[model samples]
Target: MSARSLRQVTLLTVVLLLGASLGLALSLRVWPVSCPEAEPYQLGRTGRCVWAAWAADAYVVDGDLEQARERVSALGAQAADTVCSLAVGDCATCRGGQAEAGADLAAALGLACPDGVEGAP
Candidate 1:
């Protein structure tokens, strides 16, 4: 082949490869991240794991904030607050006692609060 023709072919190949590589990179970055199979929690819209309902209940009732904090740390403060607001609306009244609070928190988390547990709704 003539040198001019060969150069044109080489340039075309390089440009095509570069374009394909850029497209692939953009696609990978734009794709949503997923949680591994071992995780039992659902990921929020932003691809972050929402807190375990049990953990939040434990924190509210038993003052076991460590486990809850560990789980929520991935969500950041603002996201955690948002999740809390969605799950537990006007729950402050339940704080009068640990036993009642625990049941209320469980109910707020969509779990079955034990029968005859006061303040559970």
Candidate 2:
């Protein structure tokens, strides 16, 4: 191939590679991003509630019911207050997390959550 043509191809390949890399990076970030909506246990926000719920679930899985209850109760108390402050995306995420945790905790405690709250996979 002519040198001019080769240079053009190389540039295009580099551009495409960089674009792909950037897209991959962004996609990865979207999936496993850290909680950024609230301070842990300090604010009465959905994020805090969700985090507490998750903590409760983990505690329950580890066979600690008292700790799990404490976590869920605290989160539940705060959830209503913080729900309004969260953005739509954050609110949905927080609510989902809380529900999942609550369900897991309930299951661990042998309580029937007949409402069928979803749990995280």
Candidate 3:
């Protein structure tokens, strides 16, 4: 093969590999690939955290401290559990994000978080 043709082929190969890697990374972010057993728990925790945060924020904005506090406490509990089961590395990052979401919920609710929670964001 000509030198230019070989260079073109190499470039194409590199592009394809990069595209594949990017796709894989994006897919992993949206879909849970490992820990099938933990998938349900993760999804439940995520949903609960999100809802709690929204509710707490609304209550806080409305000056309903009591309701906000209740929501925050519930969120903190969910965050603690979700953070605890996450492994190191990328799993840890995902779990940490969940924990942060929970913390945000608690903050909005004006509630003090409990101690000894794993991966407190």
Candidate 4:
């Protein structure tokens, strides 16, 4: 092929690739995504709510800020429950790193983690 034709073909290939990539990204991100009914969470040994973050991205993509916040809050509740259940007696002592988890998860929810709710037995 001529240099001019080769350049045209290369440009066309690049455009096609870009379009396909963009389409795939959008398909994954757009609404109608398969979101979980609940946060399938388990408290890790290190005290992180491992799967509670599953809803945030989908809720955000759906433009439901309230749902996203609620999901995180539910995660926090689950984390606390795990702490309580696993603790031998004083649950207050084992409420571990969840303050940080709350903070990190809160960002995804577009809110800050609320305080003063810890310290249980």
Candidate 5:
């Protein structure tokens, strides 16, 4: 092949490789996890963490402080303390006295809940 054609082919290959690498990195790094109908214990770390956080929030909203604490305990003692704070009138925007601390903890853990109206009864 001509020198110019060879250079063009090499450049094209480099671009294609870079594009593929970027696509792969994004797919693996920012992928979504959906495990509806499964218990938190049945999921991977991210899914489990998210479920526990949301469940804690649900329990808090329902005035079930014991269950909320149990779910938050799965996250960690630090998380439990931070989240449980909301249960004790420490929050300014808790809905109808329901603490939203679980959602905060989930977000802090770098996970977003699946699309839907959160905290719907």
Candidate 6:
């Protein structure tokens, strides 16, 4: 090939290789384990952890969402506790009570979360 064409080909190959290397370095990395789902996991979420592993396993095993819900619902309290512990680790009972009350109030509203709402505005 001509010198000019060879130079262009080499530059193009370098650019493509660099782009691929960066993409591979930034690619999503995840480690699955025993844990509850983090609400709705989607793109841009760190590690992209999706549905609760246990709930997914139950659903896969039973082939029904009813079993999934029944299983995941029972972990609600534990999930809430973990959230609180993460938020106010070693804090007094007042903060914990406030968190509980706020959660209860939100639940009592009986409204689906914004994410659950469908259709256009």
Give TM-scores for every candidate, taking all chains together and pairing residue i with residue i.
0.33, 0.33, 0.36, 0.33, 0.31, 0.27
TM-score of 5: 0.31
The superposed Cα distance between candidate 5 and the true structure at residue 46, in angstroms, equals 9.4
User: Each prediction's Cα lDDT score?
Assistant: 0.50, 0.50, 0.50, 0.49, 0.50, 0.39
CA error at residue 59 for candidate 3, angstroms = 38
Report how far off residue 43 is in candidate 6 (Å). Answer: 12
> Residue 114 CA error for candidate 4 (Å)?
1.7
Model 3 agreement with the true structure over 1-121: per-residue lDDT tens digits: 9999999999999999999999999886666544333332244322322344445557666888687767656667754333333211113324336454444444444343455433333
Instruction: Give every collision pair in model 5.
Output: none
Score residue 105 of candidate 5 by CA lDDT.
Answer: 42
Residue-wise C-alpha lDDT for candidate 4, range 12-89, written one tens digit per residue:
999999999999988765533332335433333333334544455467567786887677567777633442333222
Query: What range of 10 consecutive residues in model 5 has the weakest lDDT sum?
Result: 39-48
User: Where is the poorest 10-residue window by lDDT in model 4?
Assistant: 85-94
Candidate 2: regions farther than 4 A off = 1-49, 78-102, 109-114, 118-121
Write down the RMSD of all candidates, one decimal each: 10.8, 12.4, 12.8, 14.5, 11.4, 14.4
| Residue 2 lDDT, candidate 5, scale 0-100 | 100
Top-scoring candidate (TM-score): 3
* Clash number by candidate, in order: 0, 0, 0, 0, 0, 0
Ranking by TM-score: 3, 2, 1, 4, 5, 6
**How does model 5 fare in lDDT?**
0.50
Output the TM-score of candidate 3: 0.36
